[model samples]
Target: MRHRRGLVRLWDYAKPSWRRLTLALLCMGVEAVCVPLMIWTAKELLPPILQSGQSQALRRLDLVALAVLALGLLKGLASYGHYYLGNYVGQRVIQGLRGDLFWHLLRLSPRFFEETRSGKLISHLTNDVAVLQQVLSENIAQVLVTPLMALGTVVLMFLLSWRLTLLVLLGAPLLAWVLQQMGRKMRRVTERMQQRLADLTSLFQEVVLGIRIVQCFNAEERERQRFGAENERTFAAIMKGHQLQALMTPTIEWIGLTGMLLLLWFGGREVILAQRMGAEDLIALLGSVQVLITQMRKFGRLHLILQQGRAAGQRILEVLDLPPEIPQKPNAIALPDIQGHIQFDHVSFQYSSGEMVLHDISFEVRPGEVVAIAGPSGAGKTTLANLIPRLYDVTSGSVRVEGYDVRDWDLASLRSHIGIVPQEVLLFTGTVRENIAYGQPEASDEEVEWAARMAYAHEFIVRLPQGYQTWVGERGAKLSRGQCQRIAIARALLRNPRILILDEATSALDSESETLVQKALERLMEGRTTLIIAHRLSSIRHAHRILILDQGRIVEEGSHEELLGRGGLYSKLYELQSLQARGEGLE
Candidate 1:
């Protein structure tokens, strides 16, 4: 029952083409009937052509040739029907499964991507899905057809001579044992190979992404050596599977040979000594045995192929079966455009490991309020910003917008109304206009340029080779860091989200770039309910109110002057920065 579940789950992916599958099976059934007929034709014609000298022998031989030819034609047509239709179903299924896997991956929590490698996920979608396509299209046909061939051949053997059939049947249990053991070995090796392949993929992605680092460090040789190691592991795994598959064929063959020897010895005595059957009957029975062996060979080969696919299927299924970390409730309603009133009431959050990052934090930002959150490194500043968008749900307490818990809001609607420009800028490979209007792809060209102008990006953009139409390379590589940041801001501006988050946006910029970006940020913050996670204390001194977080708690909260006057952690940090700026800093 459990095994059926696994197979049924895979079949469910293909169920969309149930009609095609049914038609394919009907075609396979027609093809299967041809196998025993061909054997019977050979049996009927052999004696007349080889031994009998009767005048009608030639006619009988000719008739058998025509019958065989007709059967072959029927088999060919039926084979094509099943093979093509089966493949069609297989293609549709894997395509759907791949789409589903990608869609699910995109919907998973941000933590999933942090913990998982891009290369491994790519492997699952590409290599693993390909394996499933091959197995289902090719190997699955054999799985369905071989058994029918075997059963038909066995029935013919019984009709020809029940005693010899019994001998063959007696060997079935032993052959089954050999096959079962080989299947286990094949599955183990295939699974290990898949794991190694995923590792190799990860190494490839990492090396490509960090090629500049490798070259800058003059570590090309080291990187090559690392790649060689991963390549060798993958090779070792492939060879292991190849060796197992090689052994399986011969192992099954040797068992078949044993069965054949037993049948030949026992069945030969009946024909030669007792005259119980004609030489023609013996030939027919032997032909049936040969057909049975061929079917068994097909079965064994199919088993080996399926084991490899099964390993891949397991990987794909692992991802598909994962429950989304944050699932929308059945009764969840779409959140309307909010007034940007943000509140955190005793909010606390932990990662998947359950190590608390925010604890018992309570705060509120009125609509259009400019509140800055300042803290030392690792103070959960960004995490607090993240909770506002439901990137990670609060571990305890509630984060609310407009007096309603974020969980109550529709995820898409809520995120759509909130704009986030993280410290790290992300841009796709597209024109400036496209990137700027990504949040709302339907925005007009005038609107895009307006947003760019608001972000202070239009001034520099018009200087580019193609102005707003210039193609930015992958992740906006063709643009400067400051340019990318401005583009991201323009995207957020086009979104026109009620709530905005700026996470150390200018920290990575030069003085010239920072001045431009800071001014742009000030413009962006004019009327929005903003949460500023500040890295440079100087940047947020003019913020209406500041909240200082430390070790997951709100250590201080007040206007910049008020906090500085209190002479606490904020005051000390401010003083240190002030000294550092004036060249009177402590070493």
Candidate 2:
């Protein structure tokens, strides 16, 4: 039943290309008709050449040969059209499906990505889709054409000699039962194989993204062993699928051949011994039987392809079926221009697993206020900042922006006015200029340069080989950490967002790099409602107010000087950091 649904979904994907599919089916029909005609002409040509009169036999042979040649030509032309159009339709369907999958993935909430492996998603996009493409490109044509060819041949055989045709068809039920059982097993095996492949891909991606950590710890051999184990599992699953396919093909062929042997024995006896059937008729019956057997074998192979495709299609559909965790409502309105007044009113939040991350978090940041959120690690500082942009809707209470609940605003419009610069800045594989203008693609060259200048990135960018056009390697590997951060800031600056969330943006840099980035960040925060999630106490000293959190609730809210005077959790944390900075031990 699941496989049936998958096939229906696949057909829906194919609906847009009905014209090409219709033309391909017509070509297949023409080709199917020509096969029987060619076989009949051969049978007719045989009897004429065997006649005693040479001139009459030669004349008949010429006409039959011409008829056979014309049929072959027409069949070849139709075959070409069938193959070309079928593949064209297949490519179109896969392209649309792949594109839709990607678009859907992009619209999914960040939590979805946090829970799902990048490798598994990448496998769905590339490997699984490629498997489905094989069904569309090649197997689909065989699926349609082979059955038609087989049916036409069966009809011709029955017309010539029903008894022989009936004898050959006695194996049909057995062959079908074998196909059904093997195909079920093949689907199971193929699904497992795809899962193993996804695991292998996930492991490889995890290792590559963390190669530095692996090399630093000298765990290359350990990683290799882990990868080898996964590869072996994938190999085993693939070989199991291959074994089923190998066993099925010959099992089906043997059944078909057994039926053919029975037909030959019975029909040959009737022709030679009883003289109940003519030689020409027996010959044509044999020809038709060969075509039928070939079609049956093709059907067996097509079944395997269909099983594999169904497995792949199921995987792809699983992703498409997921509703976006943060879906926008039909009545959601565009976020109007605001002065960046963000308020969290009795807000509490939790993940999908029901582990509460924030509790009764009430805060109000007036327009252009720089509110620093200081906390120890895992204190929900970042989570609190995330609520402002509606990355995750609150579990119970409301988060409002400019007097409107964020849930009432369009997601895109809400996020467009916000900018984030995380501690781990990620730059795409593109030019430095492109990275800066990523948020605002239509930014003029001068605007990009101006943002770069504001972020203090213009000097280093201009020093690169191609200036702004210099290609930053993956994740900005070619640039320094400080350079990447500044570029990220420049990206935010270019968008000129009304609100900014700096989640430890300067936490990962050395003193020299941090100094430069901090200066750039100060320029970025001017006249914007900013939420700075920072662990370093020194960075928030100049903020208008600091909200210190512990265990998912605000423990202290005051200016840095006021918090220092209070001697609460904030003071203790500040004292610890101060002692560490001064190279002193805490007693």
TM-scores for every candidate against the unseen true structure: 0.89, 0.93
In terms of lDDT, the poorest run of 10 residues in model 2 is 1-10
CA lDDT, every prediction? Answer: 0.86, 0.88
**TM-score winner:** 2
List candidate 2 segments past 4 Å from native: 1-12, 179-201, 212-258, 475-477, 584-587
Task: Return the lDDT, model 1, position 186.
Answer: 76
Off by over 4 Å in 1: 1-4, 51-55, 115-120, 204-206, 209-268, 307-315, 329-335, 463-467, 473-477, 578-587
Give the per-residue lDDT of model 2 (tens digit) for 4-112.
4776777787898899999999999999999998898888887786685888888899999999999999999999999999999899889889999999998899899
lDDT tens string, model 1, 1-587?
Answer: 33344577877878988998999999899888898888888788877878667878889889989999999999999999999998888888788788889999989898888778776677778888998889988678879999998988888888888988888888887787777787777777877887887777777778888889988999989888988998998999999989877887787778778777877788889999987887788888888888887787678778878877887888888888877888786666566677899999999899887789999999999999999999898999999999988999998999998788889888898898899999998788888888898889999999999999988999999999889888886744388889889999998888888999999998788768888888889989888999998878989998999999999999999999999999999999999888876784333
Error of 2 at 306 (Å): 1.5
Assess the local accuracy of residue 523 in candidate 1 as a C-alpha lDDT between 0 and 100. Answer: 89
